[model samples]
Target: MVLQRPAAPDFVKRVFTAEEPDLVWAGDMTEIVTEEGRLYLATVIDLFSRRLLGYPMGARHDADLVVAALNMAAATRGGDVRGGIFHSDRLNSPSTRPGSSPGPAAGWASPSPWAGSARASTTPSARRSTAY
Candidate 1:
């Protein structure tokens, strides 16, 4: 369940009107362990385009780390998400993280139903992203 408090993009209606190309764009993270038994890998993807947007590898999960990747995607798209839907299984947690951290805000999520050069902001984790 995408834990975005803000309503889906205004273009969500358009996404549901079709099937391929301009439909759903889901994103989620996965953990990859190397021979050293280290946890790493946080990824964001464009489900419709089947493209990997941004990711970072580390020993644990943190709100800032997630923001870093999300920021990359936002910067990549120049912060233009007039109409788009961002689906993710993970919850966005910010309020639960330590102080002196990235604030809570909505991340851009694409422009229109298509995914190419658009961004998706975050509402900051309400419960601090797990540092796993």
Candidate 2:
């Protein structure tokens, strides 16, 4: 039998631009293959400045890793992410997971946005410079 996953509410609606920092934030996860094993990297970025607000790597790709990244992002902004929107393709599971509270109660806006299939194209550029 095929089971259907609950639909995530759309808050972004394909609009990925943010006029100011903290107004819109996006998160994504990547898997890295290593000699020893695979590692997961979770990142949170400020859509306006295209700045990487949070990044956390771990052996497991679970809610804990996502939460750590979110906490780091919040801490990066001085623990004040009260009214900002956080969009992500893989957040629905973590957010709805039992005992997880990575939403409004954690200082972020309610009904977090989901990027779904457009995650890749909508995510901010990750280019880096050699010079500091």
- Could you tell me every candidate's TM-score relative to the true structure? 0.48, 0.69
User: Which portions of model 1 show Cα errors greater than 4 Å?
Assistant: 1-24, 91-132
Candidate 1 local accuracy as lDDT? 0.44
Q: State residue 40's C-alpha deviation in candidate 2, in Å.
A: 0.5
Tell me each candidate's RMSD, in Å, in order. 8.8, 8.8
User: How far in Å is the alpha carbon of 37 misplaced in model 1?
Assistant: 3.9
Residues 40-102, candidate 2: write the lDDT tens digits: 888989989999988888887665566677777776887766567777774445433433533
Task: Report, for all candidates in order, the number of backbone clashes.
Answer: 20, 0
Candidate 2 clash pair list: none
Candidate 1 residue-wise lDDT, 1-132, digit = tens: 323333334434334232554234444455676898866565655556666655656665554555545544444455543344455432333332334344222444332211223333443222333332
The best candidate in terms of lDDT: 2
Global CA lDDT computed for model 2: 0.60
